[model samples]
Target: MKPLLRLVEEIRHGIPSHYHVDLENRLAIAWGERKRKRFDIKPRSRGENLVATRENRARIIYLQAQDEDCLLFLAFILAYSPRSCVDFKTTEFVEFHDYALDNIQQRASPETEKLLKTMAIRRGFNQNLHYLNYMQTMFPKGIREQEPIGETLVSTAAESVGNEMRIDEIGRDDRGRQIERMYSNGPISQVSMFGELLSNAIQSSHQWRKERGLGESTTNCWTTMIPRDPNEDISITIWLGRRDGHRVNTALMVEPTWSSPSLPMPE
Candidate 1:
């Protein structure tokens, strides 16, 4: 039998009778058909040092039981790993399964858990790298700069310095140390003034889609903001479409698509 089919069967057997499967979306939804009952399933402690180290590591696993997608299992695992230090190799699915089993059995050694976490983190980072590389290919060069406005600010400041200010003399003092003085008639603003200017610039550039046409149809519009500092720049992208699905569209506003290896960062 196919792996997905096998998984579905196992899930059907393992899950409580209160849950129903949404075959169209391949999602399982839990319902309150049965009287409320709570099982005494003791929570397992991973241990202090282990948990602390796990927190510091970059591997992560994000799972949503509400989603019928099989990839949710993998997503859950990746969400738990530390940031920036783990790798998951796509070709090594067997290794991933083994590690997952070990993790569930509580038989995973500290070292083994650490290694698995590292692999998961690396996997996520590599996936992001691949996505960024693809985007780089799609977008031509010079479409955007790392710090567009920052470069402008620095260049403007440098150009204005000599032309706007004068350094007339440098003379030796009584102790033979050189003395220098400069004068400027250029405009200077307090930090708050600069901040206000930046805020206004961003607000002005923001775009909002206004309703057009009749019926129950609506769309969204987007705008770009220019930052005063190169490092502080930001851009917002929006997708607008009619919503026709039941599941919560936490990430994508449209219908849920197939699980891709490179998921976009959560907003």
Candidate 2:
């Protein structure tokens, strides 16, 4: 699985990209324009990537995703909004006209349907925390509770010693800190900002770890969260395994970068 931002395009059969703005707006409305803007909800070309390091202009970037990588980002920005707020059925936007139908139909694939259904069944009740707890239970051995390292590590827990275990940590940065506070207080209305990315990162790490023959029946996941620069995007580093102690390297660095000068609307 590619980045959740990228996997989203795999579901887009032939819808024009411009209509995606409607989907982005829907998220802005659901999560509030403030969060939407804070997360940089608007999609941009690969080369169009911008880091707001200036005063009061800071924003978060996921995975340093490039242009070709962002081709599917709109798909996520749209699908996630509905999945987080109302439900998958609400992804359709009549204002976009017939293109909206194409959008909805394209996303009706078995995988997308299954993913959305799982989210509905799993996280529909208590939002992201319920879903997080569900994923934790999937570990071969349950995660062990651990104390936080000051404000840097809001929460840290490691699964039982096994080839298929993960060290989960919630950061203490602005966005992460807020998420921590929300979870400690009560049920949150939406999924954590890093929820989708964390899932993909864990899956990707697991696949790579197994390829290296690190574990007997499963791969290991070493996830650590350290406070990061508020102005910088959150960075996730996946280690091969406890014994390997090496970063899982891939060809993503050399992937071809391409982009359309303009998006052609489908007839």
Candidate 3:
């Protein structure tokens, strides 16, 4: 197996040239920002690519960059404010709104584990080991576990290429414009085949637009397997899109979540 450092290097190389910042750059910047008291990375704004690395920067390159590597961002968040991660996808507390949501669901990320542990010790959370045990069960299911159950070794998009193509049809309005849906998840792993396909799709979309002499394509979409029934335990990720014409909002959740995961009932 290749070393972890090699993996990061390769994955970073795979990042589309459009991206302003990649994971490694963000971590280095976040670490430096710690020395100053004020939160330098502005928590808000709409950007297509990452911004240049600088303290007190208005944009978090990672938020708009890609979906994976949120672990580093959260790791920094943990160092600064651990509880904010509990609301991983839905924290309006910061100006960067949904910045944390970019690549959530990365529980087992090594960066997350390492920094979280270090932050715990630094913050004195490790004074008692029990707290670490408690921290493990927080939100996303796969953070600390070394299992790849949540990751896919194959590309669902590639696997489906040339297969029967079916688009979810929706009734049109009086104007006869086609209604579109949006879907995708982040915290996508650099090592996973599924993520690679998504990355390819994004890159392809950019080219597709340039070929047509068009600007960015508004048809941002993503898919996941999901269960067909409430009673059955079987699950498949169904493709879902954002209702609003904006990017995924951490304030809301992916479609058909219907209801948020019931947080543990009050004690």
lDDT of each: 0.25, 0.30, 0.29
Positional deviation of 28 in candidate 3, in angstroms? 24
Tens-place lDDT per residue, model 2, 145-183, is 333333433434334333222324332432443122111
Q: What TM-score does candidate 1 get on C-alpha atoms?
A: 0.18
Taking the tens digit of each residue's C-alpha lDDT, what string does model 1 give over 141-173? Answer: 211221123222222111113312111233222
- Indicate the worst ten consecutive residues by lDDT in candidate 2: 55-64
Candidate 1 stretches with Cα past 4 Å from truth are: 1-8, 12-47, 55-58, 61-232, 235-267
List the candidates' TM-scores in order. 0.18, 0.18, 0.20
Per-residue lDDT of model 3, residues 26-108, tens digit only: 33333322223335586433231222312224223223222222322333322332222233443232433233234232234
The total number of steric clashes, by the backbone 3 Å criterion, in model 3 comes to 21
Error of 3 at 237 (Å): 6.0
Native-to-model Cα distance after best TM-score fit, residue 185 in candidate 1, in Å: 52
